[model samples]
Target: MIRTLQSGQQCQVRIASVTGESTLLYSTHRILLEAPNWTLDGRSLILNGDGKLWRLDITSGTLIEIPLGGIPDLNNDHVLAPDGESIFLSANDGHIYRAPLTGGHAQRITPDDGSFHFLHGVSPDGAELAYVGIGGGDFRQPGRLMTIASDGGAPARVNVGEGHCDGPEYSPDGKWLYLNTESFSTEPGHAQLARIRVDGTGFEQLLESKTVDWFPHLSPDGQYASYIRFPSGTQGHPADLPVAVVLVSTGDWKTPLHTWPLFGGQGTLNVNSWSPDSEHFAYVAYPPATQTED
Candidate 1:
């Protein structure tokens, strides 16, 4: 329940109920803990830390590092397969790779050559994977929302817009794709959560905010959406500000049930994965300023 990071710190992260009772879920000594994805059975958590994917057993409190092998430069948005057999991750090398959960070789899934591919999530059926691909040489330029069959094939663009589209994920039923679009023209960059039918129809905007709200991940039951809400005034540098884990009712996008502030110091919180039961999620909290010995 408590994991001591290698830095000699005791369990720095603790989970408590709304009443403040310790849930004893995780306590890690690791300085950088990000992208915690629970296995399908909920027995283990897969997290990316120290530039590698680690499998932590909940019961035994043992940590095993999954060898990515040849694949390097993995991002935070890796996803586990529906059956929990394999995982799909994004490599900074401009490609997507699928590797076994137990550790083995990794196979490339995208041939994007350029640094246009940004990984998102895999569908519940494991048939398709969604990602963001920018056409212009500069990543700041608006990108495209794309989806491809997991087996490897030509990817298809889902949205046509000038604003950069990113953080694509599928509804629990795989009926719709949820993503965020950031338009430069809008003040503070409007963050729009849109739903696109899998068949590529009925592209509708579900929610838009003047403040940046991205990383839409549907809860396991598919009833609520847990996403990151960047505080206002931190537009272009969202990665450098604190964030809140907000929950929105899927049935009604206008209603927000809960919001929890995270990484309060002058740092940033990058939320990556959600638990299978949707009870708890994992994220990385970075400290902004460090003391230097004078």
Candidate 2:
């Protein structure tokens, strides 16, 4: 189901620089926006709201809808294609679609194999995609790491373990798929940052923490990463929570270089939002409107 802001709540679009500065790019109470994707040219940010795609021009602050044909309402799971002119979208109908960035007919990529496809990353070479598949659309079943050709084919499962995982994004070098998984913990919903080889070997946990982490997105240059940290006992990345977006050096993921505390989850930093230059990344925040002194 598409989620909306409750009365008196507001959505904020923000960018955080690796050098430790934060900027509020835009905000609204009219609609709930989430999961920003920085365009390859660094001129705009792509976001989704009300089951549709929107592009926000950073310089002019113009927000426009990118129309799509032959696709269901979109979810927060979307990734920019490596080509810079197209995107891969995971619609609410349990299928992934490819559409031009300029907006046009969306070509369905998943083969309807009785699994729900949630898109995360496109390979650096643009030949493959990494995502999480929920078998038979069952929430009770653990999600499995999946990969498929960018043009569409039978998806292959990359075994990390028998646990729920999400945000299987490719490292900028095309060697590792970064994600958060429950395999490291016996505690339910205790997803920790992890990475596995594209060939399905060398699975390693990146960090150890009581906080439930989700979505470890690497910068385009592969120097830094950003992820959302939920409360210790939070289950399944729920919305409207007090979450923190932590930035860390890829070489030493244990120590945080910076952290931005905000009121959002689920839709905040679910995808890679790093600018092409890798200097800045974007995210969303949903906070209640402040009471006015009338």
Query: Which candidate comes out best when scored by lDDT?
Result: 2
RMSD values, in order shown = 5.2, 1.9
TM-score of each: 0.82, 0.98
Over 4 Å off, model 2 = 290-294
Q: Give the alpha carbon lDDT tens digit for every residue of 2-52 in model 2.
A: 989989988889989999888888888898998999999999999999999
Error of 2 at 89 (Å): 0.2
lDDT tens digits, residues 1-294, model 1?
A: 111133333222323222223334455545455556778887887776666788877777687788878788565557888888999887666778899998888999887545467677788889999888866437666768899899888888885466777778888888988887764335545666677787878877877565677767777788777667776555432443456656677887776776666543111222235567666554444433341111
Off by over 4 Å in 1: 1-30, 113-115, 183-185, 264-272, 287-294
TM-score of 1: 0.82
Model 1 clash pairs are: 3-27, 4-29, 5-29, 5-30
lDDT of each: 0.66, 0.94
- Model 1's alpha-carbon lDDT is 0.66
